[model samples]
Target: MAHANTVLINALRRTANKLSSGTSYQWGHMGSCNCGNLAQELTLLSKAEIHEFAMAGRGDWREQVEEFCPASGLPMDLLIAEMLKNGLTTTDLQHLEKLSDRKILAGIPSEIRSKMKYNSREDVILYLSTWANLLEDELLEAAPSLESLLKWEEPIPIPEDILL
Candidate 1:
């Protein structure tokens, strides 16, 4: 599972909500595709801007991620860097674009998983929600225990005169 940072979680949920709410989805459009939508949520760049940036490079999100160079200063690279800083890996981006991450797919019910396709908006929704759930599970596992919380909550002792 990808690291469960707050930014990443918010981006995933926002992307899923946008798509579910009838955001224009076109498989062939670079700006409105699966990864593009998520990129919009993360980078606050419009689809047109994302598409323009993508066109400045070759191939799709997968190729862009594969060829990412932080020093290149390309818009797509910069956008990708932002996503990485928020806890997504290039591998996760590739999988988001292609819907081909075996581990993530494996967690989906076989009936639904078998029907999923990369360019389908519903499939992307399923993928994002499932991935979010996995990340949430990881976050929950790493949460501080009640004992630890109580330890931190214990009031520091002070002389009664301090209250005067």
Candidate 2:
């Protein structure tokens, strides 16, 4: 699962919104595909730029991910590096392209999740929203309470037995 952060969570929602509002979604298109769209949101790159980077490599997102090497100067590798720097793992990239992340999938309602088609824009939108929600929950859970943040250090009370 992705490490939850506000930026990544917001990006996921924005991607979902873009899809919901009819942003171009074609599973076959390298730039507009599932991972591609998220990459766009994360890296602030256009679809054409993403597509071009992918083309410089030999395979689809899955293959590119499998072969990802941060040290390599290949365009696709560089692009994937940027996505990683934004908090995604290679496994996450693989799952994003296929909507196969079990954690994210589990966040969706069973009825809709079970029927989801990886290539369908509606399904993609739903998946994105669910992922964002999951991340938001994670972010909240990890946040410090106001009392904890404002607390000052206190003296530890030694156990009575140890003091004796």
Candidate 3:
């Protein structure tokens, strides 16, 4: 699950980097950019500060993107949506739209799926629906801490009371 989270984080970072390039505003500012002030609001760091830390004269955008990912615990679809808001091309939008339906339903262990009552087709659909709505609400809130980001990766048994 940590691996999956890492993959999702990397995807979001890539999307953010792509969106950042097309915007006219500086990294930290609120408007005229896809992710609100996310680039700026994070770490309370100035543009120069973030540049010094992430860029470090390497000049690789991918590295910078990785640095940004841990700050946003969001899964990739919401990240992609935020990027699209900044002006993703149609092809990019199509790619991102596909992700929304895929991530929650992809490759879970049957044990875990069964726990969610997702043993059948209809259950999986409902799981996806709930996950989508939960993600929408989750993303609009503040960026999560790295620990919170990691916590979601843990596989634990749900109490019977909670399951019902």
Per-residue error at 151 for model 2, in Å?
3.1
Model 3 lDDT tens row, 1-164: 11113223433454344344442433232221222223333233344444444333232323233333433543332333344344333342232222223444454445755454312323433443444344444454546777787786668888999878
Clashing pairs in 2: none
Writing each residue's lDDT as its tens digit, candidate 2 over 33-137 gives 999899899889899999999998989999999999888899889989988877788998898888999999988889888898899999989888998898888
Worst 10 residues of 2 by lDDT: 149-158
- TM-score of model 1 relative to the true fold? 0.88
Over 4 Å off in model 3, which ranges?
1-37, 65-134, 138-164
User: Model 2: residues >4 Å from true position, as ranges?
Assistant: 153-164
TM-score: model 2 vs. ground truth: 0.90
Clashing pairs in 3: 28-40
lDDT of 1: 0.87
What lDDT is reached at residue 134 by model 1?
Answer: 78
